[model samples]
Target: MLSLLIRGRFPSPAVADVGAGTGLLTRELAARGFAGTAIEPNDVMREEGIRRSDLNFPFRWLNGSGEATGLADQSADWLLMGNAFHWTDIENSLQEFRRVLRPDGFFTPIWVMLDTDRDATVQSVDRLLADAIPSFSRHSDVVMKFINSLSTGTSDFSNHRVFLDSHHSEVMSKERYLNMWRSRNDLQSALNPREWEAVIKKIDELLVEEKVVLKLRTYAWIFEPEEIPH
Candidate 1:
């Protein structure tokens, strides 16, 4: 995903990563030789993002949301919003993305998720999580709604969809995985203590080779305006 976004692409283009959270994506963009602003709604997360970022890379952090990123019109070369898309007003965000994106720019919402549908371990984990948390939902479920929104969400801008892909995997030590799960404000907001613990226990018990094996795939929906009258 990182390579596809940055491959052969000059660092002169600016990227606006809405709902950027702790700047994980922003840092990745920086490491890829892009200079951009990370807009996060939460002050704490924005601060942490700034602290963790290497400012020498021309990375900037700000407090904002998907609907109103506080960026100038046609200011961003790329508007990449994901991870926190479900937390946003879909329709409003789509409009905002179009507004901030340059005429020739791209807007893509990217997802790096476990291969839940194809991988056995992922399916087992998903089932247990769905059972444990009554409100639990899969990544695919949310993506469908996002895909639908592209056509029906806004009338102001016509979106031309393109498929771009990437994949990778990593082994997660129990301790590291536990910390990640616990640190996610999104999950913490949705899962209670029991539901959360149940998930941890399930994953811990299902570990492969004493660590969680994640077969990950990156998905992106690149949006291009059908016509940009400049």
Candidate 2:
């Protein structure tokens, strides 16, 4: 999506991952040769990022909020928020994003979502998740009109592009499938020990009895910055 929207065969030179949690995308950007800075306010999430990181990439982690980043003015060529933009004060954050971006910089928000049309089995699994964890239903909508309105439709934002990518990964077995469910933030917090165990047991019974893997769809939204008035 970045490649298509930016219209460049290669990646950007420098990027700042705002509200970056666990540095997942930070390291990915760094691995692509972009000098990346991860700004996260939560200490536990930041620590988890550091712990999850390879420690080889030059990822500078900063404790900052999206509304007021500690970065300098017009410093970044690109700003990225992966699955973390919803938690920000979007109005102020977009203003701050414009403040710190160069004249030709871009602000891209990437979200990896589920592909609902792949199979009936996948749909059934999704229903199970929604039933076991109601928040899953709410979290299905990652980007909303109000959230996009914060940064988009402004004179300062430009080259607005939205890309949808669908890739399929097959979870070999029921245990692997259950692990994916267990890793979800919604299920992790919503379900108690016994409840989680029951959910997992139910998943195994469903998947093994039916025989299927999971399908996923990823969506990415990229926006280039227009030159702000002096």
Candidate 3:
């Protein structure tokens, strides 16, 4: 989505992936020729990213929060926050973004939601998450609304663009699909043993009945800051 929003083939140089859990999106940027830094608060997740992801470029892993990025002012050309933005202090994060981004820099927040287009597999995954966790209800709507509000605001940004795409991928087995869900923070921490077992069993049953495939709706917006007079 940002690729379209920025009207560019790849991310800008000097990019920062704030709260880059496990470097999923960071790897994508690195692949696209951006030399980026990752600011992650979770030590375990940061280590996992360093160990697991193939980041060939020289990328610094800063121990920091989105609200208080330790990077210098006007030092970055682009800032990216993944699905983890919902967990951040948005007002503070915005200030941090303003501080770090250059005059014409871009700020992008991305959310990848499973596309529930009446596909049995998509519905199965949705049901598994909804039934397995109680806190799911409170987050999805509120966070989406917050993102929408931030995307709409014009006080800070001179130009902005929004992109929503329906994306799909295939997962061979229920276990493979389950592993993806297991990586999510809320689902991993909240689901009790009984709930987790039940969810997995249900997912297995659904896959057996109607082979599970992954479908997702990815939403992103790129914000270009108003150029500051030197």
Candidate 4:
């Protein structure tokens, strides 16, 4: 999916994966032969990503955030955020991206959501979260709205087009899917200890009853930089 986004943008794309956690996206790009850098603000996460990365291709791990990447001007051909754009300061990040990207660079933000409608267990888990954490669905909706709004061009970026695409799905075991939920800091932080326990218990039960094969949906919003008069 990511390769498809950067295919024709540059002969050898110099990519920056902002907010890259554990270098998942960075490693993918490197494996595909992209000369790339992974910028992460958290020391622990960044170090872990570096430790886990075993790519033979060129890649750099940096201590940085989307708002302040500390990269050279016009140095990157493509900037990508995989499931981490929501954590960024959008205005500052957009300005920083504009500064670091070449004139023709592309910015793509991607996310993966559990396809709740496709599976009863997934819907049950969604309902459990909705009941346990009031902000779960609301926050998700807000993020979606903010991402959608970016298509109109933000104050800092006046000449860009955001092309939205989705419906790409991947299959995984129920246990792996549940672990993905457990890894979410947002959901964990929102619930009290007892509520968290109850939610997890219910999710486990549902997974067992429903036979636990998850269909995960991937969504990408590709922002193309275009010429605009000031």
Candidate 5:
């Protein structure tokens, strides 16, 4: 999605992956021939990324937060946050993004959300989670509200124009899909040991019994700084 959007916009763009957990998106950009810089605050995740990285085309890794990237002014052509924007102080992060990005640079926040309404299996899983964790719906609602703010340009991005786009129904196998849910921080933190075990067991049973496959939706909220009149 990002590659397609930047196809004709910039030639060999310098990309910054802020809050880059395990450098997944950073490596993807590097593999696509972009000059990439991954800024992560967590030492463990950063080290793990380095350990797993292909040394042939190494990208720079820095200890930094979204609110203070520690990058040179106007150095990046694109700044991206993959499933990490909601964890940031949005106002400060946007200001820092503007400071580091070139005048023509773009800022994008991407998220992959399960399309529960369209998939019966996902809807069932959602209900199961809700029943298992009382605060699950509240936590999800907060995140969704933040996402909506970004999509509608209501998050105090006064100097930027925001465009929303989504690619729906990206398929994945049941095992891979369950792993994705298991990896979520909210689920990990919210569930106690017994509850977590029960939830996972139920999920496994449902997936196997129903032969479930996940259909996820990818959402991108693209922010472009508005040009000042000469």
Candidate 6:
């Protein structure tokens, strides 16, 4: 996935990872030989990201957000919103991104989620979520919105899309799986304290395996603003 997004596309890129929670994506970019600053707003999350990363890597975690990045104008080669767009005011964030990006820069937004269409465990969990929480909604809709935002008057960008069917999976213990949900902002936001606990408990009971392999599909789009008349 990184190869497709980076190979022959950028030369020693300067990336601004907006909303870089725990700096996971920033670390990935650093591992790929890309260097830049990771902007995060939440003090706790930023500190957590700083703790998760060190100076050895090619990037540094900073205090910022997509709306007000505190970065010099036109400084980034790429502005990445990896799962960060969901929390942003789309229009304002885009304008800020454009401000930070060079005229030739790219805006890459990546959305990744469980492949419920292909994985029964994830499907079961979704079903459970819907059944347990009356307000629960399919996560796939967010993926669609991520894709559709491009055509919905967001910007005059030449969009590049990753394959919808492209997916990746990870094998983890059931404990790790449950732990993942325990930390997810989406689930926590959607489910109240008791309700979320019940859902997690149900999932815990549902999974019989010590380890589970989950497949995740990624919806990625690369956006380049069109040149305007001088």
TM-score for each model: 0.76, 0.76, 0.77, 0.80, 0.83, 0.81
Flag the better candidate by lDDT, 1 or 4: 4
In the range 50-90, model 3's lDDT, one tens digit per residue, is 88755455577888889988999999888888898779876
Clashing pairs in 1: none
**Candidate 4 vs candidate 6, TM-score winner:** 6
Residues 1-230 of candidate 1 have per-residue lDDT tens digits of: 54565444534788888889888888777776777788998998888887886648566788789999999998988778766776788678877877888777877777777666557776776677667667777556776556455455343323544365566787887677667656656555677788677778777777656576667777666755334212
Q: Tens digit of lDDT per residue, candidate 4, span 1-230?
A: 55775776578888999998888888878878888789999999999998887755477889999999979999988998988887887768878888888888888888766655675766777788888877676355666666566555553333454455555455567677678778877888888888787788888777653335666666666665553212
Candidate maximizing lDDT: 6
Top TM-score: which candidate number? 5
What are the runs in model 2 whose C-alpha is more than 4 Å off? 1-12, 129-136, 142-159, 163-173, 184-195, 209-213, 227-230
Report, for every candidate in turn, its global Cα lDDT versus the true structure. 0.71, 0.70, 0.71, 0.75, 0.76, 0.78
Assess the local accuracy of residue 195 in candidate 6 as a C-alpha lDDT between 0 and 100: 77
Per-candidate count of clashing residue pairs (backbone under 3 Å): 0, 0, 0, 0, 0, 0
- Per-residue lDDT tens digits for candidate 2, residues 1-230, read 46444437325556789988888788777766667688998999999988877757677888987888799998887888887776777668888988888777878766665666775666777788778877676465545443355346642333344454557655566666677677776666787888888877776777644435566666565665653322
Clashing pairs in 3: none
Question: Candidate 6 regions off by >4 Å?
Answer: 1-10, 138-140, 149-165, 184-198, 227-230
- Across 56-170, the per-residue lDDT of candidate 6 in tens digits comes to 8778778888889989999988888787786887668877887888888877778777777889988898788878767778666776766666545554433334434377899
- Across residues 34-107, which tens digit of lDDT does each residue of candidate 5 receive? 87789999999998887777767557888999999989999988899988889988778878888898888888
lDDT winner between 3 and 6, please give it: 6
Candidate 4 Cα errors over 4 Å, as ranges: 1-5, 55-57, 130-138, 151-164, 184-195, 209-211, 227-230
Count of backbone collisions within predicted model 6? 0
